[model samples]
Target: MGGKQGPQHPRTPRRRFDIMSRYWTFLLVLVRVILPLKAEETSACPADCACLEPQHHILCSNASLTSVPSILAEGTLELRLDYNNLTSLDTGAFLGLSQLSALHLSYCGLRNIQPGTFEDLHSLEYLHLDNNLLESLEEGTFRNLSRLLYLHLENNKLTFLGPDVFQPMDKLSALYLSHNLLTELSNQTFNDLPQLRWLYLNNNLLSNISIKAFAGPRRLRKLSLEANNLTSVPRALRQASSLQSLRLSSNPIRQLGSFGRKLRSLTELYLDELGLQEVSSTSFAGMRRLRTLSLRGNQLEILSLPLLGAQTELLLSRNPWRCDCRLLWLYVHLQVMKSKVSQGEALCSTPTALAGQRLLNVELQKLTCPAFGSHLTTAAPYKVPTYSATTAKRTPPQVMETPKTTTRTTIVSLATKATQPPPVQHPVPASNAVPERWDPCLAELISKVAVRPKGEGALMVTWSTIGEHDQVEVRYSTGEAVQVLWVTGELAEVELNQLHMDTDYKVCIIPLSKHVAQCTNPNPTQCAMSHTSGWGGHIQPVHMQPTPSHSALGTGVAVAVLILVLVALVLAGAYKLRSRQAGFQRHFDEDGFESERYNPDPYKLDGVYESNEEDRKIFVTAASQWSTEDEDKLDCRLATSPTVLSTPRYVTL
Candidate 1:
């Protein structure tokens, strides 16, 4: 068999096995030592930076590092390089940080970003570049950051943004571009960001925006354009159906037209510090859901009641409201809803006497119009005596009408007498006697009388005649003196001045006949007076009331009282509820067995129990004979006794 040992494999297989073992040992050593050492060196933090290993957060804030460090861990999730001196972001600045979700480069002195600077940040969700010197961003700079949700570029010097600048960031929700130098926004500036919800463009030099600028973000909820140079409300805003808040403060808008019925979802609106002088009644017609409306610091003189909603929170401070008759409508409306208006801030600015007076303090009675009494009469002419300004006594004067006709009649008689022979005037035939003609004296009745306020201390009395008359006279008396004004038109007006502000006056319209009645004639006929039913005859009294003031005060007081009563009732109810609860708790405590059992008592040795005489004797005897054996026996007896075992009585000596 030894001979057949097969030419002696001579331990060749064993030698190969040994050689393989050594090779494996070397490979193992390389894997366990050399590879780990390399990994450790690669994972080391950059200079002047702090790295959190467990959280994989690298913070290099306030570091003088001129550029982004390349020694970040592969698993870094957040990188904060704020307050650094980074001038520009190269194409592959964040090349390997795939797991990074938040990148903050705020106040980094960053001037520009290359086209592909953020190409490798596929997992980034938040990017903050605020307080930088970046004038503009190259197109496609954030092309690879599709998952980015927030981008803050505030306090930058960006003058413009190219079309489709944020096209690749479809998931972006909030974009803040405040405090920038942007002059305008193109239609396609924010294209393709369908998920965008909040966009802030405040404090920019933006004077114009394309009508379709906000068309790309269909889900937008809030948009702020405050502190811009916009002269009016942008037409672009009506397209956002889901918008909830809009801010246009500190603009140059002079007026506000109706916000088309489409903005039904709008809740908050700010128009403060603008040059607004007028607001259409329908401006907020369809904004039913609006809750907050601010109009502080504007040039508004009056606000219509329909412009404000009942549930809306309004801010109307610093506006110049004229407290006059013209503003009576607003005043009454405010008085009706005094609780809704801001009392201290709603002040008047005109009518020197009312300047600086609060709208709530304005006297509504001070705004008044004259009252008029009208009567129509065609009565016969009666003696209308003329009175002096100083005397209330009246002096009668001769009544004359158609004096020219009388003069013409005398001239005709003289001519006839001169042409005919005087001796031929034998007894005048009865048939030749001249027939008396009716005079034109019936058209002297005033059909209508209208009185209106002329100024602060005057009244304008206007009247219309029912028929044609030669002359119409207006006699008015303020109880002290009577004045007559003769007017010669179908429609006549007399402005009575120097009249007391709040006093009653009697005015009468008298019509005179055109025919004359001579007082020297021995059998002179009296001037006939027409007693027409529709003619104004008697003097009508008109009362001039003071401006409406105290009534509004009474209304305000009533409303305040009602509100106070409601508040007091609510407080009383709350107090009653609290007292009832306290009473119930007291009753429960008085009736509870736990309170009585736990109450301290001087008669008992321990507060837990009140023992009888037999029980006390038993406890004293047990305590006097207390021992280890007795305690065991007692425990055994206690375990066996029905009441002791079942009820577990607590004994106190």
Candidate 2:
């Protein structure tokens, strides 16, 4: 019974092993044959290209093929065919590539493409055809590519594009056509691209554009037209209501016209290198939202302050700005908004006296109006409104003629004509006779006071005077103590040696009259106290010493000596090495037996051993005619001795 049970168990195990072998054979056949056949049916890449599976992409760049390979992977998302020799594209060239999203055909020598060539690629979103030889595009060239978002046609020979070339790409967002031969843009060139945001047309030969050329693309944000032959600001830009940045540099535009009321959304306007001689005040009135305005590299001699917005960043460098009275208001406005103007780029380029001076460094007194000739007191009556302390919040005063009884009214009106000010008037005494008293008006004639650092805890204070004054007084405080100094001119230098370094100081200025000593009285009726200047000047005192000229000169001399010594050592070492080489060559030439034993090639010895008598005579004649300098040049070529042979040599003559 035990033997029978053992045999049955062994037979059962053998039966199970047979069934498992058959199952493993079926699985191997499915993996090796059925799965590959199914893959081949789904997608097949061309032999000349590489396919990235799972995410189908074909890479066939620089393959040097004449035509687009037809056997591309079936659901290919991207196909790279750059650097190929494809001269033209047929309608059915991409018949099976309907799933392609991006196509790269740059530098492919593509000169022409038939209409409806890309009709099969309905899902294509990006097309790169730059660096090709295409001269023109047909109206329906991109007929069915409605989903295309970006079209790159830069560096092509495209002289013109059909009006409806981009009509089918309704969803296109960006179109790059730079470095082309386009001469003009017609009205309907980009009519159907409503969603276009960026249009780059730089580095073209564009000289003209239809007035309605940019009427479309209402949602466009940026437009670049640099390096074109435009003679004036394009009137077509008025239709781009949503454009934020517009660059028109490197053009020959001589004058700027009003931007119209359409470009209200523009934030950046670049008109640099346009040869602009003048700009109308209304040229930028419509761009109230503009943040940056660049006028660099132009011929402008003057600019108006009203043309710029308050918060605009102005770039006016490299322009021939004439610094005169006409620009006084602009200089004052720039001073008030100094933080918004670039000091290094704000330079004057005209008027020989003020040329090369920074606009920020120009003093207010130096910007006097030459047209208003003579002093303000002698000029025509320039009305200046005066405010009373009690009626300061009231409306502005009206001009009125003075009565015959008041001689003081005539003098006050004449003085007020010259200055635009908060004038203060004094009551006249009834005595009508000329009193021997200093005029109180001298105290109110001071205009502006400026303070500059002079190192070593010193300050240089300069003020402009409008009327006669005896002296100028300066009062300063260091938060602990107050100090006063009296100076004699429109300019003064004060040394605060007592103040500590790096301490903040508050300073003010006042013009003093000759009656200042008498005005010190507690109840002086004839003398009045003058208005004190505000604390506009805050300075941090710094201690600095003058650089020693002798130390700098000594350093320069030491550097010169060291450089000379280094150059001399280099020349000396080179000379010694050359001399040693020449000595070794001379020594080798003098050893006759050694030269003959080592030098197997005698022709290398500068023709010392000629193969025939004719050659030997030619060499000797050339050597005898050589000049001394030419002979020295041949020292490395020629041996020292002419006959240094151990064995006798024979010529072929």
lDDT of each: 0.68, 0.69
Best by lDDT: 2
Q: State residue 189's C-alpha deviation in candidate 1, in Å.
A: 1.3
Candidate 1 local lDDT, 525-552, one digit each (tens): 2111111112132535676865569778
lDDT string, candidate 2, 1-653, tens digits: 88778767668879999999999999998899888888875567776777887778889899887998887765889999999999999888898888999999999999999998999998999999999999999877898999999999999999997888998888999999999999999999988899999999999999999988888887999999999999877889878889999999999888786666678788899999999887865477546567788989988877763434555777889987767666764676677668877767768765555678987787767664331122211112225555678967655655456554533323323345556543334443443223233332233445555555555455555555533232454555564554555555333334334444445565554444322323222222212222222232365456676479977988999999999999999999999789867766775787755444344455556433446645644222212212222213332334121121111121111
Which residue pairs does candidate 2 place in steric collision? none
The residue-level lDDT of candidate 2 at 172 comes to 96
On the 0 to 100 scale, the lDDT of residue 548 in model 1 is 67
Q: Which regions of candidate 2 fall more than 4 Å away from where they truly are?
A: 1-29, 38-50, 371-653
TM-score, one value per model? 0.52, 0.53
The alpha-carbon lDDT assigned to residue 558 of candidate 1 equals: 100
Off by over 4 Å in 1: 1-43, 305-307, 325-343, 351-354, 361-653
